[model samples]
Target: MSGTSEGPTPATDLSRPSVTQSDTTMCPSTEPAATAVARQAVAAAPPAPPRSGPGGPLPAAALTPMAQSAPTPVGFTGLAQRPPAAVPEPPLPEPPFRSAFSAAPLAMAVVDRDGLVVSANDTFGTLFGGGPEEFAGQPAADLVDLTSDARTRHAYHEVLRGGRARLRCARRLKHPDGHGLWVQITVAPLAPESPDVLLSVADISARRELQSRLRHLRNHDPVTRLPNRTLFFERLSAALEAESYERGGSGRIGLCYLDLDGFKAVNDTLGHRTGDRLLAAVAERLTRCADEAGHGRTSAPLVARLGGDEFALLVEDSTGTEQLAELAESVLTALQAPFEISGRRLSVSASIGVVERHAAGTSATALMQAADTTLYWAKADGKARWTLFDPERNARRMTRQALVSSLRAAVERGEFALEYQPLVGMDDGRLRGVEALVRWRHPQFGTLTPNRFIALAEEDGSIVPLGRWILATACRQARRWQLDHPDEPPIFVSVNVAVRQVWDSDLVADVAEVLAETGLAPHLLQLELTESAVMGSAGRPLQALRALSDMGVHIAIDDFGTGYSNLAYLSRLPVSALKLDGSFVRGFQHEERGGTAGRPSPADEVIVEAMVQLAHRLGLTVTAECVETCDQASRLRRIGCDTGQGWLYSRPVSPDRISELLGDRC
Candidate 1:
């Protein structure tokens, strides 16, 4: 204990605060005694009396002399009532959250439940050019691109209503600088218990531009700036697919495959640069035509450049063949004009193949192939024209291809057989010789004649081998007949030779080999060629014929006078006979009364007489083909025709049948 200095205490200053041990009474019982006693307390004479006021509560420290004049809560709890301890006024918000939000790169904003902007970060102000002061109290709808429309507003509502945790989209926002800002927007509720939403925006303008450029490069031709082959095919495929699914309408599609005529010549004459410019001009014109044709429709036709001089047009929902024909005609008319490039006028024409078909049954690839084939047909019919795809014609061509493929094997398979048509003496009415007609014993078509497969063979160059087979087979049969009947007049056999065979094959060598193999006399084997074939013969072809004639092989010109005949030039070659065309013989008997009806046509008789007289002067034998009636034979004989062959004598019988006829002397 220390000595108590009982100095008279200085008069307590009521104006100043005083400390006393009784300050411990202000602490709650829950506090430790030492904590309660250690608290530095202000002079508290009796706890402030409870105050009455409309306001709720006031702390003892807040009940100041100046505050007493204000309206007091009726149920105010004073110091004696022990007011609920202060809430420790939630520790001042962490600086990091405010700092991070303010420093964020993405535009961010806080929107209240009423759709008003509560707060915005620095990034938001910088991005939108509106500071927090300007943004405050402004409707959130005006700030973000969303909420401007019902669709976006609904999306915002979805995220706010907990239907979605977050929402994202591309939005176009108005910029402060009067330019549009493309942004990828993301939005989310700040908390489940809170009405505020956090909206974040990221600029995506550069990305969109890159994507657009990539798409352009993919779909367009760099030089012509027209849709390329890839885009064309894709459009065609899509059109086909759509047509297949459509109901009750004509789902027909039309395609025009065009190739610029004489384009290569232009490229060679004027440099590639000029060619490229020309191609670009052509593409523009083609695009114009497509647009004009497709005007007033929902979708325009697609025009594209395949490569070089080739271009294609896709017509979706075509009307029919007539409409396709009109389109093709319009394209042709458009191209008729000359293009002036680099101070020179260049003219070009296009061959178009138009193919129209029901979309349901066709594929894109098949349609394009058919178009290509028809385009070739246009070229074949003469360029600068358009050809429609003909299924019947295509079938014929396909059959020809099948035959050409089978022709090489036909010889090895022994599918070929020969028939003999009789040639009778005009005066004696006896068989003098027989023309060998080749027939094909096809497995599918059953007995195809020369007319059906002959052209195909010539086209594929199979005629050379086929012609050799015919010559060899005919010579063998003729030799057999001569050996069988040594006493009878020696009969001859004639084989038709194609122009391709004459030019492509060693005709003289082939005939010589056949004759030597069969031991047939040259005079006994007569080779026949069409007048046009022999008339056009010259150079190697003429030399081939002369060589055959020199080998003692009889040469005859069939279907005489039908071709441009060169009698002056004919005298130089070795031609044995002139067989009058069957057409002239058919003219002799027109339908008249019952029996051998009309009199022989005067014009035909005059022609036959003139030809016979001319042939005799040339020292060439004259034979009349197709002596079907007595009138024809009598007319032919009166005109001094040496021999006649037709159905009147025989209908191309087999070798056995011919031998039987010989034995019977018919």
Candidate 2:
């Protein structure tokens, strides 16, 4: 049913071909005209447009080869042969190597093992005012300024030898401009595969400026621009340690700690700003001392501000005490000059304490403490001076300090007791009165005399309480004695009063209260005062003395001639008796023998006679102290002295002993 209509036949029914089963061994029949037409179409077409522009185009002969290559299949006689398998193309090789040197932020360059510049980055070329072409294959060191130190070259070599992977060096680099630029160069090994070294340079001018500022702050005082305490101590410790190791421990370190005596006044009068300027001037003078002391020596003692008006100096390896003394003297001389501050010239002096100690056992704290203590001593001994450390004085000071600490509780603990020494009638050999003396029966120190602790008591202001206790105790004892010995003439009990007791307390009220409480008549309770102590009385002291005297309390001047002998004023005073100084009476035995074994000298007799005459004329009785011998006593009696007190009568005795003496007299 392959009929074709006139209009191109019915398309679906144009051709129908079938093959019977069991035809697997046979080829399918194909139209020979269709296969010939396809071959002719391919072979007859002009060759495809040329792939690339050429001088000539493909010929018709080339098309004949393409037609012969097509195989004719037996079954269809039109199938084309499949092409052979295509081969894979090899991967393209990596691009040629380029240096990373040109991309580094820092000026970078690659140097060969021999320190030759194999390549350089843009930064490096720009730094040296040359392009990479000019620097490549050139010696890297050639661009470095010749005046650059050898240390930089050595560091570079160290990095190149692989001794260090990276090195930092400061070097001067030549620039196109006249001046060279300071740079810090860092060199590092580039890669394991190459012997090239990578160098990185950065201009460090700003960093160097910051470093200089830091160094200045470290070594100088912020207030005065002088060396500070830290630097001074550092230098001192080093010097001392050096000397100790060098001399095998013979050398000494001397230090002087000085404080301006009246600097606080200056600061208060002027402003602190002016004080600061004055301090600067003082520092200059002190530094000059250090310089002069060092002379040509490389190392010198450091003078430093320890803060405020205080300063310190470290003297190393002093020759001896003489050298230290000289240094102290120099300091005094230096500080004597006036300082001009804020247009005013102010005069100031210094009190310096010097301590010299060997480095063997001396520590910084110990040395500083010694100097501080000595400085206080100088201030106390009177300002504008210097004092040297003395171990003996320090020992005594410690003892006094211990005593002071124990004194306030002494009276309350019943550690204090009173002893009495009788003042005898020189002519009658009769008891006239007794002087009350305070003693301390310390549990640890045994018995302490008045001389030992009285000064300490006065210094610490404890004497007022202690003195009150003495007055009360003495008055009570005197009343008791009067009660027991009614047959004997009534004897007065005289208690010594300290200046502090008079000044710091109402001594008159204390004495009146004691007399009233004990029922001891005022006439029997006499108060003894040193002449200087009485003279030192102010308004209250004079009032206290007058009130006591008005109460019938006999006031006697003790140690009369040794102090200010204002007898004219004494007459106006309420004092009833003048006790001649012990020193004058002890010489009495020398008078008759023209210098007997223990006799008063003729001059002593004259003085004693004159004192008695004067006292008599003033309606005052005279008592000679320290009448130790019968001859001395006899001489005093002959001189018209009314009373005598000494070992001749009896040494100061305890209450029990006094009871026994009074009992015997009765």
Candidate 3:
């Protein structure tokens, strides 16, 4: 082996010891060798035959034959002897460090200052292409394929130049026999300030394989075995980043976010295991759809299970909205078929939101949000279909979101107002009552009517507080009207109530409190609900209505004949009036109708007359809505409708206008 010293040569094996006439320094010192030789010389000299002269015993070989066989009575030297002395052998010099380096458990090699392999051990050569000598003069960096990338190449050069303390990196290497392995390469200075470094290679194939398996498990869904939400988000971010950096790319991306309709009922009725199988089946179908969608594209789409029954397909470099729509339509068609789970066939449908756009300024979060919103629109438009993202629709949804977030606050800020429409007696033309309607005086969009925001309120449960506010404000106005018109019959105030108000809030308590607070008689305060909200209402809602009725408040079914009329239900309730739906009135006036220019059809008249006669038999008054002309009012009067409402009487007006109308009626 070569040797290094403080002299001329800069390279040598740091394991072997050597000596020369001019240079005595070596990797291992010579003291142990000299000591070993001295110990050997001392052990080689024979001990003098155990003291045969004087009082010491004679040698066994010199003893007479008779003396050896018989015991000597005085000396007792007849074979009475101690065991032989153990030889004091010299300690073995340590097997050479060169031997240890050559037989190292791990593959090892030494590199010269030029970054070329000075020598490689047997293990190192075995890991490389050939024997130890074959690796001589070869570049260490190329041996491990470290030059494949510029970053790692630069780092290796830094280690060779002794500028870096150490270089530890992992590499994937393929052997000459066609097998592959993952190896960790460690390079560091052989000694302090030594340019020549030792390179150690450790095979870590098993560890790398284990890590890869664990990563796959962590990133995939257990139920469907599809990439999970974490992987989806990662891919989405990566796609966006890649698009941002590449100029030749498609520059557009799209996604289909879908949710299986009525999946909860399946999960609730069937077991989660069955639901899991269904999800897996759905994932398989979605993957096939993605593959089909990407037939002509450079890369296929990614299908991932977001959670539960929701899944997403990501398309990088998408062409446009049309392509995304086609993909969504295909997915809808695919999922429409029955999914057989646990030997029972289950039919399911999916609502998908399709969104596609240029990727230049879009972020993963923004894209996903757009997809989610579009999916909701798909469900809202109708389930079992797909809806492409429309900017106008998105803006409307954003407006709705803003309203929802601010709804409760708006009530506190007093952003709502009430208007009253008078209900007049059809026969006498006297004011019977006023129906209170709500309007939102928005700061950005002025004066939004109930048609715009009532449903939104009902959905988010903000209607509870808002409804309470309407009841209190309307009752106060009616009480003021009574105070102003004491000489005349006190007209009741009718307030429209949402069914949610009955379920979510204490309706009986709210109405009773308002009536007591405003000093209004319960009979003079009327609470109106849609026929749909009134019919089949039991449990809490029914109890609330009955309690309110027992408090002497009138309970009128609004928009009568629009829903399940359930005439049988009316006879059992404390209902006071039925306001015919405006649709029935519109039937008499529409230009496309079969009726004469401005006359009600006999069938329409008969429907109205029968409804009025039935209500009269049930001891309930009837109010006809949407009476825009005197002829409609006269016709309703002939039908025996007790009260009339709509444009003919008055459009819903301010409290002052209603007061003036009441004064006029008096």
Clashes of each: 5, 9, 0
Q: Which stretches of candidate 1 lie over 4 Å from their true place?
A: 1-204, 243-250, 536-547, 590-597, 663-666
lDDT per residue (tens digit) for residues 1-666 in model 1: 001221212222223312111111122342222212211111111123333333333233221212123222221122111223433222222223345555666576666566666555677788888664456556766666566556667767766666665555566666788887566565655534345566666776676666767877998998899999888888888888964448545688889899999999998999999999999999889989888988897566788999889999888888888878887888899999999999999999999999998898789889998999999999999999999999999998888778988998998899999999988888887788999999999998899989999888888887888889989999999999999988887789999999999778788888888898999999898989998888877899899988888889889998987887778756987899888888888877654344455554577778789989999998999889887877678878888999998888889889998887773432
Instruction: Score candidate 3 by TM-score against the native.
Output: 0.74
Q: Report per-prediction Cα RMSD to one decimal.
A: 19.8, 26.0, 15.4
The top-ranked prediction according to lDDT is 3
Error of 2 at 87 (Å): 23
| lDDT of the candidates, in the order given | 0.74, 0.71, 0.77
Top candidate, metric TM-score: 3
Tens-place lDDT digits, model 2, residues 251-368:
7788889999889988898988888888889888888888887787645666888888889887777656676778778889998888888889888899999888776677777788
TM-score of each: 0.70, 0.65, 0.74
lDDT of 3 by residue, 273-316 (tens): 88889999999999999889878778888999999899999988
The residue ranges of model 2 lying beyond 4 angstroms of the native Cα positions read 1-219, 234-251, 260-278, 296-298, 333-350, 379-385, 442-446, 483-490, 536-538, 587-601, 663-666
Instruction: Please give the range of 10 consecutive residues that has the lowest summed lDDT in model 3.
Output: 70-79
Candidate 1 colliding pairs: 53-72, 53-73, 53-74, 54-73, 55-73
